[model samples]
Target chain A: GAGVSQSPSNKVTEKGKDVELRCDPISGHTALYWYRQSLGQGLEFLIYFQGNSAPDKSGLPSDRFSAERTGGSVSTLTIQRTQQEDSAVYLCASSPNPVYEQYFGPGTRLTVT
Target chain B: AQRVTQPEKLLSVFKGAPVELKCNYSYSGSPELFWYVQYSRQRLQLLLRHISRESIKGFTADLNKGETSFHLKKPFAQEEDSAMYYCALKGFGNEKLTFGTGTRLTIIP
Candidate 1:
């Protein structure tokens, strides 16, 4: 079966610009999640969606960061007014449910200059 | 708040040697524990979960509530075991995972 897939494997943008990262979860998976990975921060959870509704956005660093899932399959993470600190690899994962093992995507490496 | 801690930022061991990667977490209630591994050039993937009590690739972890620990161990390390390991925790039911700082294990051939 095809695993989770992410788009724009790498992105470079200027400060204050906005960027959108896309994620396509595996077929029939009901749970999707976004996370960020960096040098000093390791990996940080950004948001989680269950059937197109985000229940927990606590990990979002700021209001400028938002995510949305549609059709319970595709998700997009948008970072508005990006900063250099926002430079990192954005990862997406999908699971059968919250308790099941998650399958990960290759991730989008965003660079903010 | 829930927190997962991997004390060792990096670990190196010789092939066939015993290995232990420590992971400790602090949470107010019962939480689910997991270990994630990312091999070079590969996406991160689950290595094991405390709830399953199953070993993967010759590695095992035991969750201890008394000490708040879930250390991953392998009796004989292999060269292919080298990778970045992350310890994660989540509240039971629907909850996001909180990950550790991660430990980069380098198995010497």
Candidate 2:
């Protein structure tokens, strides 16, 4: 079966710019999550979506970060006015349900110069 | 707030030697503990979960509520085991996970 997939394996952008990272979850997954990995922060949860319910944005670092999952399948994480601190690997994962194991994608490595 | 801690930032062990990667967590309620591993150039993947009580790739972890810990252990380490290991915790019914900083395990062959 096809696992989770992410686009733009690597991205380099200047500060103050905006970038969008994409994610495609498994066919029947109902839960999608975005996480960030960095040298200093390890892995930090960003947001999560479960079915048609409200998305959990508690872990988002700031207002500049946002994400949307459409049709319960694909998700996109957008960072506005990017900062150097945002340079890290953006990861996406999906699970069949709340209690199932999450499958992760290759991730998009973002660099802010 | 829920939190996971991997005390050691790095661990090194020789082939065939015993290895232990310590992990501790803090949470207000019942927590689901998990070990995630990432090999070089590979995406993070689940290594094992405390609830499963099953070993993966010769690795096993036991949840100790009294100590608030779930340490991963392997009787015999292998070179292939070298990777970054992250300990994570999810509160009951919570979709988000609190992750540790991670431990880079280096298997000396």
Candidate 3:
């Protein structure tokens, strides 16, 4: 079966620029998650979506970070006015349910220079 | 606040030797504990979960509420086991997971 997939394996941008990262969850998966991996913070949860309910954005580091899942399938994470600190590997994952095991994507490495 | 901690940044053991990767977590309520592994050039994947009480790839972990710990153990190490291991916790009814910094285990042949 196809696993979760992310776009733009690597991205390099200047500070203050905006970037959009896309994620395509596995078919029939109702739960989607966005996480960030960096040298300083390790792995940190960014946001999560479950069905049509409200998304969980508690883990977003700042107001500049936002994400939206459409049609209960594809998700896009947007970071506005990116800072050097925002440089990290953005990973996406999906699960059949909240309690089930999650499958991860190859991740997009974002570099803010 | 929920948190997971992996004390060791890196651990090395010879093949056929016993290995233990320590993990401790702090949460207000009962939490679901999991071990995720990532091999070189591979995406992170679930290695085992405490609730399942089943071993995967010869790895096992036990949840100890009293100590607030869930440590991964293997009786015999293999070179293939060399990879990054992360301990994670999800609070009851919560969708987000708190993850540890991760431990890089290297099995020497």
Q: DockQ rank, highest first?
A: 2, 3, 1
lDDT of 2 by residue, A1-113 (tens): 98999999999999999999999999999999999999766799999999999999999999999999989989999999999999999999999998999999999999999
Task: Determine which window of 10 residues in candidate 2 chain B has minimal summed lDDT.
Answer: B90-99
Across B1-109, the per-residue lDDT of candidate 1 in tens digits comes to: 8899999998999999999999999998999999999999999999999999998999999999999999999999999999999999988664688899999999999
- The segments of candidate 1 whose C-alpha lies over 4 angstroms from its true place after superposition are A52-54
Which tens-of-lDDT digit does each residue in B73-96 have in candidate 2?
A: 999999999999999999998988
After aligning candidate 1 to the native by TM-score, how far in Å is the CA of B3 from where it should be?
A: 0.1
Clashes of each: 0, 0, 0
Better of 2 and 3 by DockQ: 2
- State candidate 1's DockQ: 0.79
lDDT for each residue of candidate 3 in B1-109, tens digit (9 for 90 to 100): 9999999999999999999999999998999999999999999999998889998999999999999999999999999999999999999989887899999999999
Q: List candidate 3 stretches off by more than 4 Å.
A: none
lDDT of 1 by residue, A1-113 (tens): 88999999999999999999999999999999999998767689999998746458988999999998987889999999999999999999999987788899999999999
Worst 10 residues of 3 chain A by lDDT: A39-48
